[model samples]
Target: MVRILQQKQFVGHEIHGKSHKYYPLITKETYTKSFMKGFVRRYFSGSYRQMVSFFTKEDNLSLHELEQLLKELKDKNS
Candidate 1:
């Protein structure tokens, strides 16, 4: 837990006596987006299409699942 606190930028803590209280410094969505962007940049050369293609081919993501994901993206954009 101490190691995680040291690594994370979006976590804040308070110390009272021997006890500690931790809170988020950012929203879950913000953290996820930042983490995923870094992951994709590091592993996929910053290409979202390359990331999706790798998952669909190597991870054996079904066509139906791919269509569902596309629908969700479209819905979000709309």
Candidate 2:
């Protein structure tokens, strides 16, 4: 919690009566995007394809999920 206070992007804090309260400084979507980018960079060489390939090979992605992913990609490209 103390560490979170240091990153202005992550949270804001309130001090009251010798106690501290913290609240998010960024939206959930923004934080998730930042976190996933760092995770992919650190673990998958910054390649989203490599990340998806790893999950597919590990049987982590369901067939329906894969199809949905492909559909989204196609829609994006279209």
| Candidate number with greatest lDDT | 2
In the range 1-78, model 2's lDDT, one tens digit per residue, is 557545655777788899988777778999789899999999999999999999999999999999999999999999
TM-scores of the candidates are 0.76, 0.83
Highest-TM-score candidate: 2
Count: clashes, candidate 1: 0
Candidate 2: global Cα-lDDT?
0.89
What's the distance in Å from true for residue 75, model 1?
A: 3.2
Tens digits of per-residue lDDT, candidate 1, 6-75, equal: 4776677889999988888889899789999999999999999999999998877889989998999999
In model 2, state the lDDT of residue 8.
54
RMSD of model 2 against the true structure: 1.7
At residue 37, candidate 2 shows an lDDT of 100
